[model samples]
Target: MINRDLIEVFSDIAREKNVERSELATILEELFLYVIEKEYGDSSNCSCIVNLDKGEIEIYSEKTIVKEVDDYKVEITLEEAIGKEPDAEGDLDVGDVFVEVIDPRIFGRRLVTTAKQFFAQRLRDIERNYIYEDYINRVGEIVIGAVHQIQGGNVFINIDKTELRMPRNEQILAERYRRGDTIRAVIKSVEFTSKGPDIVISRSDNHFLYKLFEMEVPEIEDGIIDITAIARHPGSRAKIIVKSNDRRIDPVGACVGMRGSRIQAIVRELNNEKIDIINSSEQAEILVSRALSPAKPVQLFIDDDKNYCIALFEDENLDAAIGKNGMNVNLASKVTE
Candidate 1:
């Protein structure tokens, strides 16, 4: 039977995809039998088994032997049944039987054509979901993959089995990734497109900064530290507010790591983007002050109706606090909020 070759094909596919051998065998067998049942109409009396170790498959048709053939479809004559299997009876258990009645020309040329089309369509559906599941689970998590190609300034990354696209708007202005270069980014979203699933990755996403901290600082992963807020200017500068859930734990010191090694790695990944890790406070004034780190603020007054906080700073701290083109103020607003 072609079933033997089918097992081999499944094995190769499993190896390429790095899936478990048993899982691949089960999927192939289930799909193959489903195709056969769809073709034959009734699978209640038919059984299909796949032997992964031997790379073989077999199909069996179960029937009962009777003295006189009453129904040609479901019953076989006693004389013919005995010739194939002696001691077969109508009431006794004669077990399952198979005959090489399946025409290869029909199975290969007709049924298999239909089967291949069905399998291909089903596989595309599965792969689409596979891509969606992989990316959806990574929302707010950072990933590193190679930049394989580009289309209209949209970078395409080869992430595992799927290709992810980071559009120009989602990319950091100060960062550029050439073909074959590795890029670390955040999984902004996973959306469904007409063709399939679309993995929307981003370098400018604030989630990227959060994920970097999560990866760099072991305390965050262990839940000993918590990130209260994150605001970023992509390649320029970013601010993160963290607090220690456990009083004994030093959130900033732990995130900075010994000799500033952890934060340095994160900075290198961000193309030398400056990151300010500060302690978080429930008080809006204190939080806003910390959000606008590196600059000394004289006063912070929150406007209730406008939802804006007017901050007064010394002239020297004004430029440093507002940043070029008010980038720092914008980030501070986001993190403080």
Candidate 2:
């Protein structure tokens, strides 16, 4: 009855933690071994079995039958061995191995408390491993979650019962998060930590903008249009260079969608960040010229050896070419580079 009750309690916790039944059984076996080790100072001669089907746990201790018991944990007197199994009175002799069954009740309440602690910790470790394995393969994928906490400029989002962290540096500067607010971000990294997997999400990452474009534009997802390069100022502005495999389809137009619907959706998701989609070109001068959009350069001097381009713009267009804080020129450089 005690064994059944114990298994029931553990199984309930295991279900809540999403731990596999087989894993729970393995943990139960180890937990009992830990308890035995604490009680006897050693568990090398002990073995534990957990039967989930029957909700039973069986513990067995191997002891050597001797003329007299020296170490009670590993050795037992012949008389005691015979007393445990009367049917093997003649078969059991000195120097023979005697197997003794341990009663769960013998562990008492104190040991049960210890086992609970061990079991809880094992479940936590299993949960941590599960979270790590799940998110590691999902890096760079977009996840929409509710903001669960905001502390020290970091946002904690909850998605499918898992909490993901978005550090201040990874979040858009213009975005404000409150508890229960819906948020979307890309899984930037998954790192193992002592507490659990450190799943860092990002909204300001270049890949986040790429993923947003991919989601908004079916052409990008279907490989009809490929985004070759991307540069972002996060909540301010972003630029992407795209190429169309099928000449009939214009990459920039496809990304923009009909009446600017697709690009508008993405822009709204990103808190109205400006996005410039430039069609990729094979010619260096053409590509650089397209990258510096909204400001046409009068002449561009290319230094192929240094991988540099010096653009000469009209005096009035210089400010637009450079953009606020040189954001335009910096993004153009990134795209061309």
Among the numbered candidates, top TM-score falls to 2
- Runs of candidate 1 with Cα error greater than 4 angstroms are 1-121, 304-306
**Error in Å for residue 51 of model 2:** 1.7
- Residue 106 alpha-carbon offset, candidate 1, angstroms: 4.1
Model 2 lDDT, full chain set: 0.93
TM, every model:
0.69, 0.95
Best by lDDT: 2
Weakest lDDT window of 10 consecutive positions for candidate 1: 95-104
TM-score of 2: 0.95
lDDT of each model, Cα atoms only? 0.77, 0.93
